[model samples]
Target: MKEAQKIFSRPRSLRNISTHYCGGCGHGIAHRLVAEIVDELGIRERVIAVAPVGCAVIAYDYWDFDCSEAAHGRALAVATGIKRVRPQNIVFTYQGDGDLAAIGTSETIHAANRGENVTVIFINNAIYGMTGGQMAPTTLLGQRTATTPAGRQIGVHGAPLKISEMLALLPAVKYIERVSLHSPQEVLKAKSAIKRAFQSQIDNLGFSMVEVLSACPTYWDMPPKKALDWIRDVMSKEFPLGRIK
Candidate 1:
């Protein structure tokens, strides 16, 4: 019999369990990318992630590393405290658009301004995935949601909040990039951006963030494939991909 080579297997840093993400949700892909980067950087032992109170609220259940739960919109605050106390550990926060931009805006901006040595993986799915598809701070103008049945209006809802660009204005911010999970090519780019963010923290560059334009099929009321397409066609226009800072 011919010897078989193992071409694929789960990353050591990722837990082997079923995820609770909705079908076609980009959280799963984002989670895998983080785990892969952690394993590749050999920082699994020292990685401490602060999970947010959004769609990825139970993110600690997926990643096989030290994790702490934070109150709604408090992931960055918790991560800041953890990093300040234990500068030796690799600290990061996994948050969603609702958690980071809506309620946690203050913490996000202040953390970047202070140049805190922490990595932030921000998933911008536009809608609040964990909260019955409510409109999020990043939700596109004219997009419909549970709270915006008549479609988001410029006068009523205002424009979508470009939080990534806002944070890039801070001098203390080391790196800021926006990536998407609409296609395989974009997914690879997202991984690269995430890795760079993590590496920035490792190099003590301070305040690295990667804003990933992810998909929420259930909220969007679209099929899995259509959700990905919508990201590439519609979402990317508002939040273009590339390094901002």
Candidate 2:
């Protein structure tokens, strides 16, 4: 019998502990990808992640590196300060749709506009996962949520905000890519995009962000498999993937 090769293992930058994300939630996968990228780049010691106040509020618990908890919707601001004070550190912010596109809109825009030397990991699950299933700024039009039980209406709720596209228009932004976690191939692409985002910051290139179209099965009220399917079939249509800038 041939010995089994160790094909996969946990990333050194990731702590050996279970995450609090709900089943089918994409946060875990995103966390692992970040950890893997940090390890690959050999920057775990110098990396500093700013955790958001949404579903990933306790992200510090998973990453085996320096992390800071920011006020709700202030992750970018916090990351900006850290990166400025410690110019040599690899700084990044992990934020959700509500935190990034809604309450933190100003911070997001200003940071990118200023060309802050920091990476941003924006998780767009379409709805507010941490605080009930409210309609997030990235929530697809006509999508049902706790606040929009009858489905989101254009005239009343307005159209979904294309934040990534808006950010790409800024001259200071060096890179911006929208990726999804619905399929294996896309996951690989997401990892690549994330790595590039980090690399851009490392090279002292202006602001870089990778918008990940993650899934929220519990909030979506769908099975894990169905939730992933929705991200591919339904969500991707609204927020198409690729290098936006």
Candidate 3:
């Protein structure tokens, strides 16, 4: 007789095709992780994901969960509405630095401060990706993007926005952490954090967030290795991976 299939299995949430993201883009990894969690939690039938404009704008295509396309910078508002009406469904918003920290800062902040019971997967790659390399709210000091061609200087452009830290200060935020996918170890930590964030909501914990310091090799004008090195040596110092509060 054939051997029984292993208990472990892959998620059906992912599409069976090569993604359109650039090589080494972290969104694909994050999407896979989220999808895995959805399947593991057996919420694939009831999970609803909200996608915003940015590299993650088309996340719906890759994830098999029910998804809604929100206007640029309006994902949180849409997510809040869905969760309010359908409290039984698990709601998550996948957003990039440009969408979450820049254009949608108000929406994100209000959602967290209001103690909204939703999961936020905020990807901070430092620069804009989908709209070409441009400065984002998380863009580091002295980093060049389309808007900051000569590198970001605080005297002119202002300091980078540490959104996770800022949200951690809000009393309504129950759990907040930052993790990276730079290595296998870090990937495990991120997976744990993502799981906790979801479990927290399942317990009605409120406003949990995992700020993932991702890499943007294409926008940084560097190869995948150097982009990762930059994330380790440069970005980590400014953003610092781990629980902020």
In the range 39-100, model 1's lDDT, one tens digit per residue, is 99999999999999998989999999999999999899999999999999999999999999
Which candidate number would show the highest lDDT if scored against the true structure?
2
Report the candidate with higher lDDT, 1 versus 3.
1
TM-score of each: 0.98, 0.98, 0.95
The alpha-carbon lDDT assigned to residue 165 of candidate 1 equals 92
Error of 2 at 15 (Å): 0.9
For candidate 1, the C-alpha RMSD (Å) to the true structure equals 0.9
In angstroms, give how far residue 233 of model 3 lies from its true place. Answer: 1.2
Estimate the Cα RMSD of every predicted model relative to the unseen true structure: 0.9, 0.8, 1.8
Off by over 4 Å in 2: none
lDDT tens digits by residue: candidate 2, 1-245 = 99999888999999999999998899999999999999999998899999999999999999999999999899999999998999999999999999999999999999999999999999999999999999998889889999999999999999999999999999999999999999999999999999999999899988999999999999899999999999999999999999999
* Clash number for each model: 0, 0, 0
Full-model lDDT for every candidate: 0.93, 0.95, 0.89
Off by over 4 Å in 1: none
- Cα miss at 48, model 1 (Å)? 0.2
* Native-to-model Cα distance after best TM-score fit, residue 123 in candidate 1, in Å: 0.2
